[model samples]
Target: MSPLDQLFSNYLPVFLGTGIGAILVISALVGSRLLAPYSEERNKGTTYECGMLPIRRASTNVGMRFYLYAILFIVFDVEAVFIFPWALSYLAVGPQAYWEMVVFVGILAVGLAYAWKKGALRWQ
Candidate 1:
């Protein structure tokens, strides 16, 4: 077989995956358009969350600290999660990986320091 044919054969799974994804998406959209509910009125359109009516207007001011703590939690939480795999791979990959993790942690520490200096952690 030619090089192009060989390449495609080697990557057939990838192309099949993409084609399958496209087919599924198109089928879902078409199926929904044909069979889904078409109500566009007052009761069917109103927003609801946690089985409660959304009372707060989106433009109203809310606490910034709520979001700050959420963001901080996600950042460190993600960092903590990533460190485990890095720690596990340390022996197989040797000290270079450890140093790379040190650098990664250092950068994260710098960002955290900057945030701390700016009082993002404060409950005010």
Candidate 2:
């Protein structure tokens, strides 16, 4: 077979799949637009807050400390997740896996130390 024919044969399935996916998405969107209900009530566009009328605008300032605490929590949470599986299987894997996990925990410890020194752990 010619190179052009071979290339077309290899890509034919991909092209067909993409075309079919696009058609399906477009048809779904068009069908939703045609069949969905339309509303013009005054309260329809108002802000909703737990079934109660919103008392104020939603936008507000959030302290950077909140984000820092969230990041630290996520980091340690992931560390725990990794450590659990390794703790269960480390005996079978031997000393190399143990040392690798030690290094991983060491890196995380250094990060925690740096964050502590920078006062990221401080609440006030």
Top-scoring candidate (lDDT): 2
User: Which 10 consecutive positions of candidate 2 have the poorest summed lDDT?
Assistant: 55-64
Q: What is the clash count for each candidate, in the order shown? A: 0, 0
The residue pairs that clash in candidate 2, if any, are none
Cα deviation at 10, candidate 2, in Å, is 43
Name the runs in model 2 displaced over 4 angstroms. Answer: 1-55
Residues 1-124 of candidate 1: C-alpha lDDT, one tens digit per residue: 9999999899998989999999999999999999997876877666767677788676788798999988988998999999988877798999899898999999999989999999997788
Give the root-mean-square deviation of each candidate in angstroms.
Answer: 6.4, 8.3
Q: For candidate 1, which ten residues in a row score worst on lDDT?
A: 39-48
Best by TM-score: 2
Give each model a TM-score.
Answer: 0.49, 0.52
Assess the local accuracy of residue 65 in candidate 2 as a C-alpha lDDT between 0 and 100. Answer: 94
Judge candidate 2 at residue 44 and give its lDDT: 85
lDDT of each: 0.89, 0.95
Error of 2 at 11 (Å): 40
